[model samples]
Target: MLNKSEISFSFVFSIIVMAELICGSVESLSTYHYFTKPSILISLIFFFWKHAQHLDAKTKWLTLLALLFSLLGDVFLMFVNASANYFISGLLAFLLAHIMYVLVFLRKKKNSKKVLPFTALLLIYAATLFYFLKAGLGDLLIPVIVYMGIILLMAITAFLRQGNVTKNSFILVFLGALFFITSDSLLALNKFYEPLPFSNISIMLTYSIAQLFIVFGLLKQS
Candidate 1:
């Protein structure tokens, strides 16, 4: 059950996410936007930290670390124009974040009897996406492929946790992984393939919701 403070924080969090979406959609991807971008994840970090006190030490650390890396990714991506290295840095940060998420989710039972079908489905989707994106990936092929692998692993682990965690919690985290992958897919499409209409809005919308669901799902584990 949620307390008053948690409820209030959630309301405020929703407002902040909405503001970020609106601002991200309207503003050009300039230095100013970069400076403002970190605010979203920073707020989420606080949200996670505040609620994480109830979690076990290992879970708490993993959750916080994931959020920290995500925050770093947001900051680094902001400076992608200043230096291409920043894009690499951002990629690495998010990669680490996904790794942390996979580790956290995998703490549950590894061999679930019910998850095989979902696992096969996700694997097929990942393979199809890689096939489509491979031609355009060129020099960045290896890193992107590795990133995709980790995220698919993360999503699979989330689904496999069904019996290990609350039903609501599992659903939330699984959807979070789904949206995270969707956001990243849109990002790759825009950068390596043709630009999608309203890519910024779509990517950030899904990305922000992904983080929120993941954070809250983990919080529910406590």
Candidate 2:
């Protein structure tokens, strides 16, 4: 269980992340990215670090590996507007992070009872998304297809843990996966389709919340 100190630190960090995101949403305060994004990543790392002593070596390593790639994804995407390569690199990093999360979730999966329903849900969501985005994704067709498959697989695996783990644990991770899907969908739509008003705020908020839910859920299992 998290001690008072850990809880306080996590709370403070979360607030900082929120403030940074809010500041970033406004025109003049965009410079806050330097502090906000890194702090968000660091908060996650610190949370895991504090709890690492309680986890198995393999679990510790895998979780940290996932977070590391996520940090890289954040950094790469920061420069996405400057170069297409940066966006591609960011996508690949996040894809690897999702793969790691899938592995982590599968390791914790103790029951197969819910797999079919989860698979069906993921398939329907992916199919609908692809249908809408396919026309605009001309050059990115193959990459987008592959990314969608991986993320959908991640979501399915997350839901499959429902009956296996504690209800709270399952719900947190499952919701994290769902928020991840929402965040990525909005991101793609904004970049490849049409820009939504305040897209930056929405994307960062959902993305931050998704990471926090997953991290806290895994930590709770400790």
The number of the candidate with the highest lDDT is 1
lDDT tens per residue, model 1, 43-149: 88888887788788888898889999999998888778799889899999999999999989987745776788887888898888877788898888999989988
Model 1 spans > 4 angstroms off: 1-6, 27-32
| Local distance difference test, each candidate | 0.84, 0.82
Q: What is the lDDT of residue 23 in candidate 1?
A: 68
RMSD (Cα, Å) of candidate 2?
A: 1.9
Ten contiguous residues with the weakest lDDT in model 1: 27-36
lDDT for 119 in candidate 2 is 81
